[model samples]
Target: MSAARPAGPVGGVTGCVFPPATEARLAPARRIADAVLFEGYVLYPYRASAAKNRLRWQFGVLVPPGYGRDSGEHSHQRTECLLEPRGPGGHLAVELRFLRARRRTVQRAAAPGPDAYLTVPELELSDRVLTPWDEGVPESVRLLLPLERLTRPEGVEHPFLLPARRETEPVTEKGAPVGRLRYATEEVSGVLRLRARELPGPYGALRLTAVVANTGGWTAPPAGADRADALPHSLLSAHLLLALDRGRFLSATDPPRWAAPAVAECAGEHTWPVLADPEGGDDVLLSSPIILEDHPRIAPESPAALYDATEIDEILALRTACLTDREMREARGTDARAGAVVDFAASLPPEVLERLHGAVRSLREVSPVPGAADASGEQPWWDPGADRGVDPARDTVAVGGVAVGAGSRVLLRPGRRRTDAQDLFLDGRTALVEAVLHDVDGSVHLAVTVEDDPGADLWRAQGRFRYFQPDEVTPLEAS
Candidate 1:
């Protein structure tokens, strides 16, 4: 993979291959990428019998076209990113990564014969419990494309395949063979199409579009076939890592004002590209099926991948710590990764747990107020109630020539700028204003509840209500 080489389509390349010197170059990005790759590989409680664990592969699943077409799952993902190449001999290295699901079936000998075995959902051995599980085998396809070749009208198309595999592992009970695990996976085929075109902007930026599709042959499943049936032939957690030889890639989420228009034109389907270099370089871009912000990272305090990325590490650790001995055993027996998570959670010291409790990502310097701090001398800015200038309950905003405040009545008329589609249904509905709120930006909002809704009282009791801007409501006459 050389930048000086002429542009041409490279095919039949399979494996986790990184450009020269890029393995270390992409280390930081790979850490976050690994988290994304196995975002939901397994859930907390980690036991195969857990309800949440039953339905797996929630993210970045590119199922067979035949199954996806009818099931609403996707068969492909597309990503578009902007880049500025400093030289004509520049090149792009793309690594397409995904998981291949392997179905493991537990089997027990029926009559002590070598070939005679009875399939079972689970087999309890002397040492552990064996349950039928679907495991993900990491797979990747690497490609190096010349930027000059991508500029061609026809672009470049590369096809790749992951061959089928089958294996068996014997399970023993005190050195005696009791059962075995049969693992099988179907062949998965996919193609990547990359095209680059010059943008109309003065920045001389180039837009690169990469589309990855699952072209594996699949027979339409039976009427009752579920995701588990189609999963073995699917690409789980499909994502791409793109590295530039000698250019910088612009942020698609937060581009500079001058490049805003060009960034707006960038589009994607089931895929989003974000700047990946943790040091703030723009040479590496991570295109993921999971939408992520620029330079997304795993928290340093996070001890391990809990599969529930949305959960706080402290909370997960605490929850895992409280699991029953039987539950822990079940989790440990479910999969090797699950066993590792269990061990990791149990080994955290008090100080490590405290660190995982929380960390303030950033803070702003607040000017000292004469009487802001108490005897403790801690900053009062941490407490919102410390600020006495604002009161939501007493705030008032003029609407339709009326001073609308708490306990006022208004008719909702959601404006075209409405943020939620449900707001349209509230249009022309009578609502009781609970409070007039002012945001930090000095914008006024009227929090109200539908007067006729049966849950109006409950909503007020819970302090939950819909909010509308000053112009989105009209003051009604007092009854």
Candidate 2:
């Protein structure tokens, strides 16, 4: 189900209090904006080898100019925003920081003279040659002078450069022999800085734009560049740090429902966004977020009194159905963690177990005519009612602990044990029960549409529906 966007600040904060609609809220909004700032932020199942990973680098792609010409457009390397300040008479300061690789160029002399070899007399010395002597020596003479005596009298004396050979080319007995000297080597380091200026406002919002580029001349050129003009390129990771002061930041982004608890906590640290462009691209470079902790495991059962036993069983059953035989084998062959998952999937009832296995095998087959299999005096392959001996007539029908049937409005109970992905987003939420399907086993499942879910149509053109066991919901009494 799609989550309702929260109107106010979304992140939990520590330290100072934030003004209404200010920096506190601004942080989270920025995070949400950053989520799309880079391409391929996340993939389904989120495994490294998942098929969706092939589509990585789908967002925040900053392609070098002319690189993506095949697509008729170049990627944008900059993003800007106009942020409203929470209060009047305050200044705003922003610092945009991102990862930059170190690049340097070395310059060597075009012509180097023969290396000069100098020898020193027996004395400690700090440098090979001592310059600015009280008296200059004739180039014709070789001298071994005391370095310490020249600098300070009475210290441990050291011998300075004693020119061993003065190679001279006599010219007509009139010109002094000329000696060539070597030039010193030099290196230049690359640099990148975020630039912005203070703009005066009549106590309102201010504009902030961040530009990322290859400022250094030594960067490698983008792909498909002409060889003559091939320039160096500099790539940056997506993880950026934007420091702001003076104005209270308000909304930035809302937390994603699919984020694990650990990811959510890191996002709450006032960090803008989490993952970005896990699959790398030369045109679109991104910085990965630092994940300091792992996600907490959802418990198999909860001891809280409000926890629903029937809902737990149903969740376990559905989860088991989702597992493939290959996954079961892998789990069994792997460690305890995999074994636990295998154990859970193995706990489904016999009829449901067979249905799961059949579904896996028939994923590519066309569906048979509705009730055709049943008409043949055989149970439907996908029937959820097969082998159920209980009768619904003798069982009580309930929603949220209240006896309910069609047209009954009930508030979803909060704090239900979330043992499955389907249950996680529904907890503490409300839904309307459009219908109730009773199985031959006397178990009732509510067909509900969450008030907040933004429905979508797949290739089959069927609307997504959410179901819940009666015990998972509680009755909302009249006030």
Best prediction by lDDT = 1
Put down candidate 1 lDDT per residue, 358-442, tens digits, no spaces: 7786865554664376557664544556667667788788887789989988988898765688999788999998987776676
Candidates in order: C-alpha RMSD to true structure: 9.4, 27.3
Which candidate comes out best when scored by TM-score?
1
Q: Candidate 2 overall Cα lDDT vs. reference?
A: 0.33
Let me know the TM-score candidate 1 reaches against the reference structure.
0.75
lDDT of each: 0.81, 0.33
Off by over 4 Å in 1: 1-16, 221-224, 365-479
